[model samples]
Target: MAEETRTASRARAVALIADVVRWAGIIAAVILVIHVILVAGEANPANGIARTIHNLADALSLGFKDLFNKPADDPKLRTLINYGLAALFWLVVSSVAARLIRRLA
Candidate 1:
């Protein structure tokens, strides 16, 4: 029936959206973690790949980008805390959002 068809279509759409949201969040977390590794490993800042990843991580930081001011003696620590929180936020928020979307739809 048309009603059944519409319901199935709607379900498919919702599923797709949920998948996208989940993947995006996971990707963001991966980027953040990678940035942390690069920084911790003392990768060259002028390198293209490092810069690109740093920019992407910053973009995804969602205001947590500057959550902690760079301390005089421990700048890396600030990066770790801020980026770590952002990554965690994305993971938790995306999971909850995907679940809610699936449930509501």
Candidate 2:
């Protein structure tokens, strides 16, 4: 009876982990698709991906600085910061998702 209980508990734990991992995959995929779309729209297809990202960071930084120098509380500035933070958050989440996917797979 004890052995059976242990086995059952282990199985349940695995199932829980699997469910979490599956959801992580779905979320990660969605994030990746969104990032690709945004990058595609902002970057020319002829540009290298690395260079594009670099250029974007530069442009965003400059814009952010310009906004900061102004009212310092502009809605557009807040929106840009929010988007940048959200993008970075999603990247970290996706990395964690990859780890979970690997473990569950």
TM-scores, each model vs. reference = 0.91, 0.35
Candidate 2: worst-modelled 10 consecutive residues by lDDT? 60-69
The segments of candidate 2 whose C-alpha lies over 4 angstroms from its true place after superposition are 39-105
Runs with alpha carbons beyond 4 Å of true place in candidate 1: none
Clash pairs, model 2 backbone:
none
For residues 4-46, could you state the per-residue lDDT of candidate 1 as single tens digits?
A: 9999999999999999999999999999999988988899999
Instruction: Give me the overall lDDT of model 2.
Output: 0.53
RMSD of every candidate to native, in Å, equals: 1.4, 10.5
For lDDT, the strongest prediction is 1
Q: After superposition, how far is residue 61 of candidate 1 from its true place, in Å?
A: 0.8
Q: For candidate 2, lDDT tens digit of each residue in 4-84?
A: 999788877866776675565455444434444545456554667646644454443333323334436553444345445
